[model samples]
Target: MAASDVTVGVIFLAQIFVGSLGNSSLLLHFLVLDFTGGRVRHTDLILKHLTVANLLTLLCRGVPQTVAALGMKVFLSDLECKLLFYVHRVGRSVSIGSTCLLSSFQAITISPGDSRWAALKEKALRYMCSSTRLNWILYGLLNVMFPVVMTGNWSHRNITCLKDFGYCSAARHDTTTDSLFAALLSFPDAVCVGLMLWSSSSMVYILHRHKQRMQHVHKVRSPKSSPEPPKPSSSW
Candidate 1:
């Protein structure tokens, strides 16, 4: 094998191993908590979902690339390719949405407890599970086109217009169809990313303001240095 191929294989292997290990650890922790009747925080629940999604993404995307890089000639059937791509897409989307949800949740949790945001915070905490469930459902439906478009490498030879994805290929759609699908996929991702950024920025701003207020309070409450009484005259 070429040196580049060896390097690629090693990179993929490292990614797959490290990513799987970390995600699995988080998943096991969550599972143990659930089984032992431990109090699981709502944030933990979101992290659990994110862990699972990360695992799926690593396995689906890394394993194939690793095998290919190693000069392996494994062949996947059409069904296998479609299923793999579909699962990978869903996992990726879920990961993004989970991150966004987690950030937004934290922002809401830390916001001032005024009447304006009190109800919003309560609703966020109360519907955390429902929100996650809805996230999964929405993304699952959004990427439903994968199964229809994806095909095994073997089929790519016969298809004139196909986009190769190493272990699989996707049939090329016309410009209009491609544009429509691209819009559909990009819309949710854009929204999720935007929300994540906005929430993260809000948290930073809130923390900064809090820190300034703390400094101000500390300065105000700190004892002022009293002036020393007039010292005795120097030795005559």
Candidate 2:
């Protein structure tokens, strides 16, 4: 039987529709801009690719399962099942990893390191799309096989794939293959989580310091800076 936790299911499904639509529209705008056959073109390509990935995520994961939840798991062949679930799984995983990589890359790019990438930061704004060619190619290929690799775990194992294509929540399978997939799955999540947390903390710290500096400036400029000399004269 196809089922999901009621309240949780409703909220998540809603999120899928809302978020996907908004992103798709933004992607369309970029597409309409006529990405010139340069680095600019690659930016559009990557963004368009991301949209397709998200669309695949919604189609292969969200819509089908939501329909199933409303009725039954119809229109599913064993092959379709594998491919559908595989596409959802891989596309989502790649999305997460890519986002993490993007954030970390930004942090590093802006870092004090005198590395080559840091030097390119000033020029990045002009050709933001061009810089991502290598990034898109490498990561795009790295995760291309994820869906294929996911098939083994989906069928021969008990790993439960989520409807939102966010992540899989599954019971343990007494098989090496399943375990291996789980490990592969967990590594990126762990690294992404750790890096995000660390990055967030640093950002928070910087903001706090900035706040203190502003407060110090205010203190220095305030009229109270020159403590009134006890109102010595007056009518007292």
Candidate 3:
């Protein structure tokens, strides 16, 4: 194998190792907390989902890429390819959605009582579980086309409309169909990312305002310095 191939394999291995380790640690921590009867917060639940998603994504994408980079010609069967791609897509979507949910929840949590999001603060915790479940279901249903479209690399013979995916290939649709599919797959992700950006910005603004208010309160409550009386005697 070329040096470049070796380097790519090494990089993939490192990413898989680090990502798996970190996500596993987080998963274990949450599991321990649950088993020990520790108080589980809404964020903790979201974090657990995020970690699991991360682990799934890492294993599915990273392992396959690593194998390919290592010059391994082992091609996945059609079913295997479909399952792997489907799961990977689901995991990726869930991960992004969970992150957005967490951000929005936190933003609501820190909003002022008079803010528009104040009402949501109370409901956020209650809905987190359902929201996560719905997120999974939505993505799972959205990526259902993978199984139908994906095939093993060995099956790519005489196929003019095939999109190669290293270990597997997918049947290519016409331009209009492809565009529609792309839009469907991207719409949810775009919304999640937009929400994340909004939440992050709101949090930063809220924190800044809070800090300014604190400074103002401190200034108001702080004792004024007494006049320096001793210096007058020296002047005399």
Candidate 4:
């Protein structure tokens, strides 16, 4: 294998192993404690659903494809290759869409009242997994045509933004076409990342301000009462 391929292989395998184990534990947690037990309520269900979607993504894309990289040299039947390609591609895309939906929902939740999607605030705050129906629908719709849109045999996408190897690119020739697809692919992801970062940072700032206020209050309450000047010697 070429050094680059080897590097890809190693990195992919590590992600596979780690993502699989971590997601499995999360799945176990959801089933054993979150869902089955009465421990889950309200927003907890949303967390459970998100974890399950992520777990599905990891298993579908990470583990099998990682293993395939190790033994990819062996020639396979046409049907086998297509099936492998199809599963890996569809699964990864679904994973991406699902994760994006999860993050977007979170962002909507934390956004202030003046935000554009402020109407979604109430829905976002509630248990999205159980109380809200839209996220699941969005996840399904985002991925429904993936298998159709992608051609399994190409190995490379006809469209542009073809960075990852396993999945075919969307562009075949024109750089403009590729750039458009790249923008499409990146916009939602970038928004999700940005929203999460902003929301988390805002919370940190709020906490810092709160701590400063408490310190001020503490100082006010326990003013270092100055000792009285020493009395003149009474012996006089």
Candidate 5:
């Protein structure tokens, strides 16, 4: 292998090592909390989901790339390629959707007591699981057709084995299928982005108002700190 390829391999390995360790540690911590404390916070639950997603992503992408970088020629059959690609895509979608859910949940949790969202606060945990289930279902359906587009044929002259698995192509050049796939992938991500931004802004506004209220209370309760009139020097 060339020096550049060795360097790339090292980097990929480092990424996999650090990422896997971090996600594992986080998931372990959350599991401990759940077992010892006998309850899991909404935030903790969301974090657990995110950690799982990250681990999946790291495994799906990093392992293959790292192995390839090491100059080991690995070939995947069509079935393996399709399954791997599907898992990677689903993991990415779940990560994004989970993040959006976390943000929106926090926003609702912190909303004014009189607001309509406050009523749903008690049910948020239940909703979290439901939303996650829905996330899986939605992404699973969205990518159901993914395997049809991917191929592991190595005979095609246009297909080159430059990267890790050269035999597997993610999609063919069919315009209609490509367009539909693009739309399916982009739609959920767009929704996630929109929800994140909206919830983030609401949380910011709530925090700002809370800070102002605290400052006002502090000012009212604080005793006067005016300096005493300067006394004549004792050594005069």
Candidate 6:
């Protein structure tokens, strides 16, 4: 193997090791809390789910890339490549959905009582669970297209041939259709990121206002300790 290939392999392996360790630690912590009857918060639930999704992502994307980087010949079959890509895509989608859910949940929970979304705050915990399940299902179904559109090119095992025009059997795949689908699949990620930004911003504003209000109250209730202006000493 070339020196460059060996270097790539080492990097991939390192990524796998570090990513696995962190995700495993997070999962372990969540499990410990669950078993000990600790009050698992709503965010905790989302985090636990995220950890699992991240681990799957790392495994699917990292391990395969690592093997390939190591210059392993004929290590994976066509079916295996399809499966790996599918799982990686699904895991990534789930992570995005979970993050969006987490942000919205926090926003709703911290919203002012009189806000329009206040009603959602009461059901936040229940919603968190249901939303996560829905996200998984939705993304899973959507990504089923991955495997369907994808085929392994055994002759050039390094590349995948994605079905586009429905007629061409050659190694070259349709780039336009592939790009379109990719953009479509990325919609959820974009939406989730926007939601997170909005929610976090609103939360920050609310807290800042609350802090100001508290400060005002403290000033009103507490007597001013500063010495009065010398009682206009000389004017008298």
| Per-model TM values vs. the true structure | 0.94, 0.60, 0.95, 0.63, 0.85, 0.83
Tens digits of lDDT, candidate 2, 121-178: 5665555455445444544554554445343223434445433222322234457967
Q: List residue ranges in candidate 2 displaced over 4 A.
A: 1-16, 32-52, 105-174, 221-236
Put down candidate 6 lDDT per residue, 33-113, tens digits, no spaces: 999998787699899889999999999888877777777644555577668778988999999888888888888888888
lDDT-sorted candidate list, best first: 3, 1, 5, 6, 2, 4
Q: Lowest-scoring 10 consecutive residues by lDDT in candidate 2?
A: 162-171
Q: Write the per-residue lDDT of candidate 3 for residues 148-218, one digit (tens) a residue.
A: 88888877656779987677788998999999999999999999999999999999999999999999999
Model 4, stretches more than 4 Å misplaced? Answer: 1-11, 35-38, 41-43, 73-123, 130-133, 153-176, 226-236
Model 3 CA lDDT for position 188: 94
Question: How would the candidate models be sorted by TM-score, starting from the highest?
Answer: 3, 1, 5, 6, 4, 2
Q: For candidate 4, lDDT tens digit of each residue in 1-236? A: 56776777788888867877887787677678744564664444555555666665666566545555655643334344445445544445445544555555655665556767688877666545443356455445544434444443344334444333343322243779657756765665566567667666665665687689799999999969898999788784
Error of 1 at 204 (Å): 0.7
TM-score of 2: 0.60
* Model 1: residues with Cα > 4 Å off, grouped in runs: 232-236
Worst 10 residues of 5 by lDDT: 155-164
TM-score result, candidate 4: 0.63
Instruction: Judging by lDDT, tell me the better candidate of 4 and 5.
Output: 5
Best candidate, TM-score-wise?
3
Q: Which should have the higher TM-score, number 2 or number 4?
A: 4
Cα lDDT for residue 91, candidate 4: 48
Name the regions of candidate 5 deviating beyond 4 angstroms.
37-39, 153-167, 225-236
Write down the RMSD of candidate 2 (Cα, Å): 7.0
Q: Tell how far residue 170 is off in model 3, in angstroms.
A: 1.2
Tens digits of lDDT, candidate 5, 1-236: 89998998899999999999999999999988877886766688788888998898889878877777777644666677778777877888889988999999999999989887888888886688888778778877887776666655442336442222543565455679668768878988999999999999999999999999999999999999999899887873
Clashes of each: 0, 1, 0, 7, 0, 0
- Model 6 spans > 4 angstroms off: 153-176, 226-236
